[model samples]
Target chain A: MTDATLTRPAFRRGVPPQLIGLGALVAFFLTVELLIQIGVINRFIVPPPSDVIGSFGRVIVEEDVFGRFLLTLSECLIAGVLLTVVGVGGGVLMHRYRLLQQACETWVAAMASAPIVLMYPLFLVIFGRSMWTMIMMGFVAALPPVILKTLEGLSGTRKVLVNVGRSFNLTPSQQFWKILFPAALPTIFVGIRLGLIFALINIVGVEFLINFGGLGQLINELAERYDLPGTYAAICFVILVSILFFMTLEKIERWLRPFD
Target chain B: MLTPANPTTQAAADDAILVVDNIVVRFETPEGPIVAVDDVSLKVKPGEFLSVIGPSGCGKSTLFNVVGGLLSDHQGTVNVAGETISGPHQSIGMVFQEESTFPWRTVTDNVAFPLELTGMPKAQRIERARHFIALVGLDGFENRYPGELSGGMRQRVSLARTLASEPKILLMDEPFAALDEQTRLLLGDKVLQIQQALKQTTLLITHNITEAVQMSDRIVVMTYRPGKVKRIVDIDLPRPRTSEIVGSEAFGRYVAQIWADLREEASRGMRDEEKHTLEHHKGGAS
Candidate 1:
């Protein structure tokens, strides 16, 4: 079935997918580093990989990199928790109530395409220039996909499974928890992954735009000072933060739905 | 020629574990109300393997659904073990034509699910589930997910789950239709063995006349649209038989008789489908 292919990551020919992805990333960094050393690409605009690596310790000690990373991680964590709870909850409610689904499905789906980051000024006014602004921003940005995907997931559960429940005389609550929820989990995880990634991106973007918190803010300050190596170093940490978040999220997803 | 309804239907109901009486289902579409099942009735005696065979779109599934309590807007009274059922009943269990095993669950967990709902203790349910699993010849693959198994194996898992419930009457709707001919025959043999061992009353819905002949004590042939019982042919095959019986003379005669009965109805169904597409095309052209 198409679902079999969609749920499991393809690992063809005895090779793991992660190793291929890692190899590509390393090759990309090496190519850029080589181009810079050969004077094919300017070092001022984009620092060489070796220079960025060399300055990592200095950036960590002088600029408190770990603190910046922690701040971003906390913001992501808070936003992640809010989106998962509200997003999945909203999807279930909307699915249960047809009127709610009809009224909001299009609006919510359209929200996914909207430039939510542009409205950071409004968030600042409402939530103020504190961490709430970034946290709220991430939550809002991530919410749509989670809700939509959850709806998709729940609705996509095969009719046969539902009938199996009904034939066996499952109560409404038991049917939902036992059949509908687990059947919808793979698609829901797709939503969670998208929502978490969106949350992380917007949180960092708000940090950079407002110049107030996290890796985004540190990168902003470093760029302003023309500390190119340190800025690249900080940008690297942003990538690191996202990869870390995704790896952790993936582990959680596996724990929640091991079959996928 | 229309053969009368099962001559034994009235006589057998007293001893029957399951009785589907006068089931008539009408589905309303833009075209208007279309009768799916029309006054069809059946009685499955305990330990009997009965099959309802018909052409595609002949409403065998609709009748199956009505009997299983999955379809409510139907004219029918389904009684299981002397209790009339207006909805899903504890004494009735259904296996479906589609892939129904929960993908997230292991084979053992899937089989143990119904017991879990009843608040049965974990160890007991797991042990009971293991017995059914072994009966279906899936002893070592208990922990594997449905996605990891082949189509035939997954059907076996679902069968094990349903059998674990020990329902008074089991309803199976085209359970092996998706498998290859060889797998279908082998699984059919396996099911026959298990059913006889447990004396499980089973009602299978299918279009395969050979399957009906091979697996059933009696076969009910249904007409096309507005499906009704067209005929009932008794197999009279000896007990403790396998699907290998298909090679025998009696099996061939039974298959031939059912095929002859279903041929006209199948043609009628195909003609209606063709006419439907023609009307749709003409309307779109206009």
Candidate 2:
């Protein structure tokens, strides 16, 4: 029995989804390039990949893109941490008290559907087109997803598992820490993914609206000056951020999901 | 219903280690109170492998929960080691059908969970966890996370974790129901061997007739919803049992007897569910 169970090899051959996504991405870029090369689409409207890459290099050398990139990444990281803590904490509390959950139902519904972009004008007035406004906007925009996901996770906790925990003489604290936390992790990660994507979009959107110092701000400056190649280059950087954020979260989910 | 008030009942007579008297569990629903376990009672002797076999929604799991003190809204009294069960008592351990192994923790940490809850020192908990790990034949995989293990191995870790607590009574709610046939059979024998070695008082809930006959000293057959005990059939087969006994004439007899009792109960359950569906449909239409 042991030998039969153990003999199966890992890394079985198949076309995995990650490879498929990469293929599709490359195909998209190629098509866009073909369109531009054939003069079907104006180069000014959608800059060619070569122009974007060249403009990206110039920005890296002149604008010290690393410094600005670090600032934006730091804002996202800090905001992500804050949103996770607050959202999960609130979810736990609300799960314990159904009344609090009920009270937040309407607000959560409103936040889910409401345009997060509307928050930029108010943030601009308060923080006056600064990094704080960008950070705070990211925090607020990301908070809803985290909260909703966590609540859904907690709500879905198995009754049998909870009873099993109790039967084993686990304290309430132990129950939450051991069973509740792990059981809720997959959904919580999903929430984190959504929150990260939203926060990235909001940070960039707010940067454009308020003229803050980030890739979004750079995109606005390039567009105002009609530097389409530079605009596309900055947009590529934003896309990279989104892809990296999503891939990192996908990695985490795989790490947390049960094996075999 | 096994209510304690019926003093003359043969089922109530015993020098049993655990006695559950007249348990009636109700769930508060939007419509009204729905009774799950209706006045069910039983006696459990020490070092006995008892199986509670019932159809779906027969409240067997609910009974196990009440006995384990995991359910609080029961009308009857349950005593473990002569003390009334108010909440989870330290003397009762549990295993459920679904994997409750924390994916974040390694197998050793998962097994050590109950010990950690009791504030046992880390070294002692690890030691005990390892002991049970070996007991469940999962020695080398201590450092592996629950996610890294197969379904059978994960359930073994859960069993190890429960056994590590060294509770006087172990409550298992269809713990192997999720596994495939081969894994279930293997684990069934493994669990029996371990239980015999340890002389643990086990109350297993399952629907598999053959499994109940193979592992149990006594099998309690329950009726349909608002479940009550239909009968308790005691098996006197010689111990140091093996899978071969499952095909034996005596084991077949036990299976036949239990099936005979279950047939009526199953028909009643189907009728009840049909009635419930009709009412639900009517309410929806209204």
Candidate 3:
């Protein structure tokens, strides 16, 4: 009963929240553009919306923005998939084994709290400051939340459900896959979404700091050369990528729990 | 009444499906070992509907855990379906409170789960799950996730899942406690209908006296903490218990009988808890 109500998102498809969120986003951007055009803000430094749009277009046509976007996307995807695998796998192991949960608790906490950007240099030393380093950094940052979420999620699974699994003479594996996992899904996805966002941010942040080959790296390169418009364009691209990632994840969350 | 022989030999018997010997359960605390269940014994005859009723912490659940092979430290043995239950046995199916129906699984998948473990092919599992789902009156909602259904509906799914396993014995732990009263009655009757059709041996643990009386052929009233069998009342009510039975004088008599036995145990349990608390406080002050 506690679990049945939890699997669905708080807001439904036709709710006012979605409408309000979209309306606010459009209004906020329009107000900013209007302020820039009316000279309330300095165009020289911040640049107007039109100029930003033009630069974005130029970057798309000349600099192969889609290819670079795909590159960044692929890295995030690889890191996300890897984080899920390692995180869920480790989580289940830890959950099933009480000693492991206790042993990994402090380690997971330390990894979760440590500055992922700082690890970029260490990864760079080891992996030579390539995309692999960025991915690893993302994984390190993302992994703790994923693992923690998995533990919390699995533990949060209703005692009622576990008893049910037991009643059916379910094996440990069967119980986990059928009962525990499903019961803990909403919380698991919360961890996954948090992990995805963390991984994306960390990957780009690492790329920016280490000057690797993603949009973040491009933004850093453009800024150093004082190509302000190009930097602006790359920043826009990053924003778009973040939005796209969020939307895709939201869609996936919906698909996984459709009726909800 | 059938009596199982030696625990090991009991399982190999042809008639009795489950035998729960005197099980003693205790929890180790900093203060001392807290006794939860003390010398509880029961047996499930083939196709018998047995309901155990007691107040909270009466160790009814602990008794179920012993039978389910969950608590090994307990002093007892459980034999299921011609096999000694060393651990969870595939021949015995279990249903828990509504939450056990995995929210992520559609009704079909949830029902098919036990079969999946048994290495049944996908098609056969699906077909079997569908049959069970229909048996539980959840035909159209097979594709719906547990999250999409009501509490009663979800419990039905859990029931379907348990039945889908085709286990010789089915164990339910307060499965209807979370539902509204109306839903509980409906589900209870639905469960009774299924049990009648399948002729499955069932053991249900509940706090609801009326539910125990309405559904069970025999009701085992349990004592409070350090639980023991207080009494066993046989329901003389005829089979295929309908909603109309709830209004019958026979049902009222059963409810009153269970309540009388339970009240004394509940009072005793409360006093035990209070005394323990006071002792803890005095020790702290010293």
Clashing pairs in 1: none
Which segments of model 1 are wrong by more than 4 Å? A1-23, A37-39, B1-3, B6-13, B284-286
Segments of candidate 3 deviating more than 4 angstroms? A1-22, A33-45, A61-64, A96-100, A167-176, A179-185, A210-212, A225-229, B1-15, B81-83, B272-286
TM-score to native of every candidate shown:
0.93, 0.87, 0.84
Best prediction by lDDT: 1
lDDT of 1 by residue, A1-260 (tens): 68766676546545677899989988999999999999999999889998998999999999999999999999999998999899999999999999999999999999999999999999999999999999999999999999999999999989999998998888889989999998898888889889988998899999999999989999899989999999999988998888898899889888988887
- Candidate 2 RMSD to the correct structure: 4.9
Candidate 2 chain B weakest ten by summed lDDT: B1-10
Instruction: Give the TM-score comparing model 2 with the true structure, all chains together.
Output: 0.87
Q: DockQ, in order, for the candidates?
A: 0.79, 0.49, 0.47
* Cα RMSDs, all models: 4.6, 4.9, 6.0
Instruction: Estimate the lDDT of model 1.
Output: 0.89
Fnat for each predicted structure, in order: 0.97, 0.72, 0.72
* Model 3: per-residue Cα lDDT over B129-184, one tens digit each: 99999999988998888888888888888888888878888888898899888888
lDDT of 1 at A214: 89
Sorted by lDDT, highest first, which candidate order results?
1, 2, 3
How high is the lDDT of residue B95 in model 1? Answer: 90
